[model samples]
Target: MTASTSTVARTATPRGSILKQRVRWGLDHALPRTVMSYAARKGDLPGRLIVESGNVETADLVDLFDAARADGPLHRGRFSFTTASQVTVKEILTSPDFRTGIVRAGGPLAGLREWADIDILGPLSAPSLLVTEPPDHTRYRKLVTRVFTVRAVEQLRGRTEQIANDLLDKLDPSSPVDLVENYCARLPLTVITEILGVEASDQERVLTFGTAAAPSLDLGLSWHTFVGVEAALQDFDAWLTDHMDHLRAHPGDNLMSKLVAATEDGVGLNDAELKATAGLVLAAGFETTVNLLGNAIALFDKHPDQLARLRAEPGLWSNAVDEVLRIDPPVLLTGRMAVRDTTVAGMRVPEGAIVSTLLAGANRDPEVFTDPNAFDVARPNAAEHMSFSAGRHYCLGASLARMEGEVGLRVLYDRFPGLALQPGAERRPTRILRGYDKLPARLS
Candidate 1:
């Protein structure tokens, strides 16, 4: 995994016909076509469309994102009235304000005050952050910024590397090993637990809840999932409360203790806020990282040259991670509600309307990027990828996630230089999170 081993600098070209075939396959079978159809037909100017139709036949959010990327960034077209209703009914997404306008109009949090269904504590309520804006976002983010600092993340590099190595050690080199479950999924779960200061014994339980929380948005708040999330929240809340009490009495090195101490200083989070923040960190921390790793592995398998180049030039791991995020971001579309009538990329959106910030679309904008379809780790502006998002709602755990990816990839290559994907392994059946349920790889 040393720098000298990387083949990134080598200019090995891909076959034209194969490339064309892949592109054709993508366009013919991709998800963006459906999304574009929906957007063109159902979306109305100056009003938010609450997409809730065609769930059975339409592609999920993840599929829509894949399609959106293909459509390039910022598709502008007029929506006919007839098309708008039919298409809108099929979309099952909540719009978060694209910028600050919605927050200024009272924001989604104001709406939450009135509805019990907006379980700020439930898994389905993960969309709460998308609905928040500006000053409130700024205040909450600043309060927790220290927890995700680069230095703090650097401290976990050793742990992340160890987790990857330990997982690698457990694999039977002679047999196919599912890299997703064994390595990718396991690493993030371990790292997040370490950050939260959750005891080793409870890590698996917490991770189960965290994974369940990942899809609450698309799944919608059904009675079954809602009750499950509620029970999980109660468990977590009680654990955090007890942990906070212990930290108050005996301050320790973990994040919980630091948050507890901050509370004592009068900048402390209330019970509700604390639960919400902790839940966010837990879900975002592991779930997103898992997908990043899984997507990267899939990309490498599909583009062996890139994988070889990365192995040769380990420093490229950093850039490669950025490219992976750009191509297959873990979290596809983030939501925002508009506060008043406004124009985004020229379309007039009314107040109280929801705007979906298509991060996948923005990343693949031909106007902003050259050969947007190609995976180029050395692209001069690779770091500009919006996979970590932007503005006030930018991910607090970005640095830590990057560190984990870098170290995890480095360790994997270093430990097994001949690692290759298993002949057959089921890709995860998920549309929102672009990840493999089982990625079988072998070390020869």
Candidate 2:
């Protein structure tokens, strides 16, 4: 077998491992709702959350977040400290002392490195912009920013619209379809691949690997998932290493080629750093956009009147995109560690304390957003949501993701004026990423 095929073959998850994941998924649902409800009202939330681990639905999560926010901007708990207030989350995210890496020296989760066996994962464990401190993050991000400049992303608009229209054309309007698979999943996967210069045939494998690797970002991962995630990362690193070499010899007008040539302060990234950076962009860009598109469609289905408003005013697509992002952020929560002792929103956070920023909760802060739970497409200032996060780590793909979402939603509704959700829409069984696994829809 060829090298790429061998990599794919070795990394495939076993049937038994898949079965284990399914059983664990069932247990997540079987956990009592009353326990979580009662805890939100009367008990120790963070302590109880050590068990639930933010596994509850989005609506249910708001209640817990509200309760947490009521206490203070920063609440120290048994399992983790959390910042539910927008002001506090922004402060922590922007603080020069805090870093994203879990294994940082003297950080709260530093010990987890050995326990999690992160070292064995090779490039998977390499610190990319997502999980590195300044100097390194600043340097790496500067190179990436040059490639994703505003003009560059804007140039992608015509092609993105074309891709959206072409995907829509493939759908049979008269029949029901799983919008997640047939529409939402395809768009970002194709877009990121085309941007990364992956061959058409290899794009499918990239997508498959990305699906497994995405979960590596989760706070809690099962052993089965761990094996699958590491294997996928290994495969991706091998492919990326080869691709970087090829890009060096024969430059193409693509992001990878630009990255290959990018230099800063008379320095450029080596092969390992290149793979990690590319992997970070691909994995983060793919699933987050997938969820973002899925959330917009699913929310529109539930709020028909708002959908009608959007249909009447296609210009409000940007507002609709922001509203959906506020209501159902693809990335639910992120964590940061103090480089030293710090104060957040008047709360004392000592050195090594890990502060979990509840992004979705911050988006729904009543102080910031009036009627925070309601989905109003026409709501003014919807762009104020903290879903894309803030400070230096703000999503690099935020603009690209937004454009794709706007175009994807607009094209779908324009094609099927009466698009409506079928009865059996299913949310993915993930706590960190909130999105539908299968949004059955009728496009009549």
Global lDDT of each candidate: 0.56, 0.74
Model 1 weakest lDDT span, ten residues long: 2-11
For model 1, the superposed segments whose C-alpha errors exceed 4 Å read 1-131, 219-235, 263-266
Model 2 ranges off by over 4 Å: 1-43, 47-56, 104-117, 120-125
- Model 2 residue 284 lDDT score: 77
| Backbone Cα, N, C clashes tallied per candidate | 23, 0
* TM value for model 2: 0.86
For residues 96-154, write the lDDT of model 1, one tens digit per residue: 33442222223433342222122122222222233345566556666677566788778
Report the C-alpha lDDT of model 2 over 201-298, residue by residue, as the tens digit.
88778878877776655533565665676577677777777776777788888887888788888788777677777777787788899999998887
Quickly count the clashes in candidate 1. 23
